[model samples]
Target: MSATAISTDVYTQVQQFYARQMHALDACRFDEYAATFTEDGEFSHTPGRPAAHTRDGIARELRAFHEERFATEPVQRRHWFNMIHLIEAPDGSLRSTFYVLVVTSRPGERQPEIAPSCVVHDVLIRADGGLLNRSRRVEHDYLLDLKRT
Candidate 1:
């Protein structure tokens, strides 16, 4: 195959990985969600929020927050990723920026509200012919009270 074709294929695989990660998170499948990242992955959900520097750290932080949210409100969150811009970096990693819209609703609620639209910046590393997220930084459209949660 040509070089361009190989690059396109790699990009497609990374897109699929992103989709699967979102689905796993919505389903509360922690292990599956964590597997989408590299062993030394890093996640910063918001500017003032604490960042997780390892796969296990991400899992623990996400699980605790999500479990608490579910317990308090009984709401389900749906994540939508769109407008993905991907570029191959000089270091052979992929740099991506994507918009995310999360809709949250409780059971039997008539209207689902958008939780905060955000843009995610990611550095994806190719490993074993597959791409895994090395780092992700999320910038939200609205301000959050970091001290609360």
Candidate 2:
């Protein structure tokens, strides 16, 4: 398969997938968020931290994020992705790269504030009639140099 320019329908499908996944996550529906991934999906965020593997592990990590970040505050989170680029792997999977901008705001706040922005690379495969993430790597802008010596 080649990395040719994708059709509008394909782009819209991928965009809708992200919309559902992010909404589930921000709504604190861990299982729904995990369902977006394959059973053996892997997710990595920080440079030094180990990647979380499997749907269960990914759900656990999301739970931890909610506890550590959201539990302490009254803020609601919204995740946005844009500038998507796609490539087709030889094995038939799709490689998707995009920028993620997360916004957070309290209930009484009049404005939302941006959280750390990130570039995410994901390997997506067709599973059970839809796209499922096989792997995801998130690189936060501020930590872009974290891997440098």
Candidate 3:
């Protein structure tokens, strides 16, 4: 498909898909978040870790990561996302570059502070007349050294 095929309606649907993705993640809805991806989706976030492939694999990886984070940090974490650019790939997929800001706040903290500003690259495909992510990768602006105690 040509770029011209990416009409306003398709664009709007893509945006909505992203919105739902962020909402699901923020709410810790792993199942819903996994649903945003295709059955054979892939996810890569942390360095040196193997990428999660398939919807079930994605859910398992996220659940383990979030559980570990919540258990150790004792802080509330929130994720905010904004689409910076959306391009139609030659294969008809939508390639998006987005900003992800993760905020962390202690129970009695004055304000929530940024944990990391991450750039996310996602390949979205049209499935069942809706957009679903085929692959997603994230790189953080800051070092994620959790052993800094």
Candidate 4:
């Protein structure tokens, strides 16, 4: 009803969107993962990796990489998002930034290892009755640290 309440509700919806998206990715559900993005969504990483454009591009690229990783060694990747901050633009789109910790494990590892963490900035919008990511850029912590030294 109030402005703050509406903002909180929007943030909550985006949070829920992230929950579903991450779970789908963790489980290697390619279709589900792709659905989290817009049809023309683009995902890119800062420092090195090339961007993947479009929903199919995002899904295919990740699927190939993950499938190969599974084939070489059954590695399970779990993504944890934290410290999410959201800002709504006047045009009704949302900009969000969050920290991600990727935990990975394989057959004989004593414990899961924490892979290099990153800060992800995403442009999200409400579409097709739900929130979808329009663009995402990941800034790797190690890469940034390396630049300092």
Query: TM-score of predicted model 4?
Result: 0.87
For lDDT, the strongest prediction is: 2
Can you tell me which runs of candidate 4 are displaced by over 4 Å?
Answer: 1-6, 145-149
Model 1: per-residue Cα lDDT over 10-111, one tens digit each: 767877998889999898887788888999999888555599878888989888777665776787889999988887776777888999999998889899
lDDT tens readout by residue for model 4, 1-149: 11222467787888899999999999998778887888999988535558989988888888877765577778888999999988776667788899999999888887998976999999999887789999999998887746543
CA lDDT of every candidate: 0.83, 0.87, 0.83, 0.84
> What TM-score does candidate 3 reach?
0.83
By TM-score, the candidates rank as: 2, 4, 1, 3
RMSD of 4: 3.6
Instruction: Please report the TM-score between candidate 2 and the true structure.
Output: 0.90
TM-score of each: 0.86, 0.90, 0.83, 0.87
* Residue pairs of candidate 4 with colliding backbone atoms: none
Q: After superposition, which runs of candidate 3 have C-alpha atoms over 4 Å from their true positions? A: 1-7, 72-74, 143-149
> In candidate 2, which residue ranges exceed 4 Å CA deviation?
46-48, 145-149
Q: Higher TM-score: candidate 1 or 3?
A: 1
lDDT-wise, the better of 3 and 4 is 4
Q: Which scores greater on TM-score, model 3 or model 4?
A: 4
Q: What is the C-alpha lDDT profile of model 3 across 59-135, one tens digit per residue?
A: 89889988877876777667787765777978788988888898888888888998688889999988887889999
